[model samples]
Target: MNKLSLTRRAFVTSASAFGLVGASGLALPYYSRANQRPAFTHGVQSGDVDATSGMVWTRTDRPARVMYEVSTTESFADAVRLAPLDTSPASDYTVKRLLTDLAADQDIFYRMTAADLSDINAVSEPIVGRFRTAPASKRDVRFAWSGDTAGQGWGIDETGMKIYSTIAKHTPDFFLHSGDTIYADGAMKDEVDLPGGGKWKNVVMIDGKRKVAETLDEYRDQWKYNMMDKHVLALSAICPTFYQWDDHEVVNNWSDSKDLTTDNRYTEKSIPVLAARAARAFHE
Candidate 1:
């Protein structure tokens, strides 16, 4: 892989847009002088912000060295290249880095290229991310808590929409999402079985054939799909988030020893090792 070299002044003058490759996976439209379609794909995102710096992330499926353009606006026409970072398979083609010298309580815009040689195949959609430098003392801090965001019916739970919307309106300093933040395997309760089916199918397979969330990919997919909801995105974008999880993210009431019996009794068949891996991936 080639190391990316970037200059603040030059990047601002040459690139046409601003974006990043981060957790949000945001993508904005791009225009080119070429007659061919743009090749850049995948959205951009930023995370882990603080007073002096924050981490920016991006995703790319293209097979090549991808370079990201960081800026404060969609039009890189007047932006600066914070750094020319490289992407690799180890991190799932997602690029992340810490940025500095930005103002607090302000939004940042960024974009990326699949490679210097390849066409800027896709540009990440613009994201207005805020950086709130932590207060000197913790005594006067204000924060809120939320949790149990689960299921994916087109990336959102109607119940979650109402709750987060109401929460965002209040403007808290931060949010703590409690457990079960995502339910990877819980499908829509069978209101009525489909004509061709006896019951709904579980999302994943467990213990070789148990059909439950049992792998890291399966678990991450659950989080990715569910978090894609606009309301969820909006809440995270606007307020700093500190999150946690519960059994539904893996299996219902997953525990060790004893009969593992409870009112909402599940088979206790969850693979502990796999469940731990899934939890770690999501927490990251």
Candidate 2:
């Protein structure tokens, strides 16, 4: 995973550059599109960072040329522009760029620009992000790890992911997502039954939340739903993350030896076929 060390000022500036700031000087989750232009809906992220290089990722609304630019300074002076990569429907409009030949233990500022395929001159607003390379020498490093976002019957809310905001405040070098990033096999409801004849209320109507993710598109939507949270977006901008998957990404306590017929919740009895489809979505 890539490591990142961000100053509070740089974080704020980066958020501003992405047009994430509202009138209150606080980062907002959603933004209006300009003339229906391609926009970075999921924000920017970096990961798989090492001493000499790192990976950056982002998604656009439409097919376009996604350009990756890197700079030593946050101002982007004398920035090195890399070749623009084409994003198509094949990759769900997502692009991952590998930045190489980087300096060790140095803060790196990166940004992305999307240009319309038909008109190269029509470029979207830049989305800025940051990351730091691991030190070449032995050094003490600090990081955090956790998981289970938008899981169970509890879906993401405006304030539910405040833990991510708390995590961002510490400015950890990197974060490890232990598991259960999304419960693709679990169906969400407005309320769930409790032991004492009570109810567990949940925020509902989220895309792909009400039903199981059977198709690849459904599986992808499970991820997109979590990105809608501002806290997740903010944490991603400031902290690099390494992700791992758990059974919930496919099904609860799923294993190669387990029988699909045992689970009444699953309509498809073929575990191998379901696992194959789930793996493709997970890797993507």
**Winning candidate number (lDDT):** 2
> Which window of 10 residues has the lowest lDDT sum in candidate 1?
202-211
Candidate 2: segments with Cα more than 4 A from true spot: 1-33, 192-205, 256-259, 264-269
The sequence of per-residue lDDT tens digits that candidate 1 reaches over residues 99-157 is 66555544455555554225444333333443244444544556678666644322233
Name the lDDT value of residue 115 in candidate 2. Answer: 69
Report how far residue 261 has shifted in candidate 1, in Å. Answer: 10
Alpha carbon lDDT of each predicted model: 0.51, 0.77
Model 2 over residues 47-114: C-alpha lDDT tens digits?
99988888898989888888766777888884666667788888788888888777898889898888
Worst 10 residues of 2 by lDDT: 3-12
Clash pairs, model 2 backbone: 1-49, 2-49
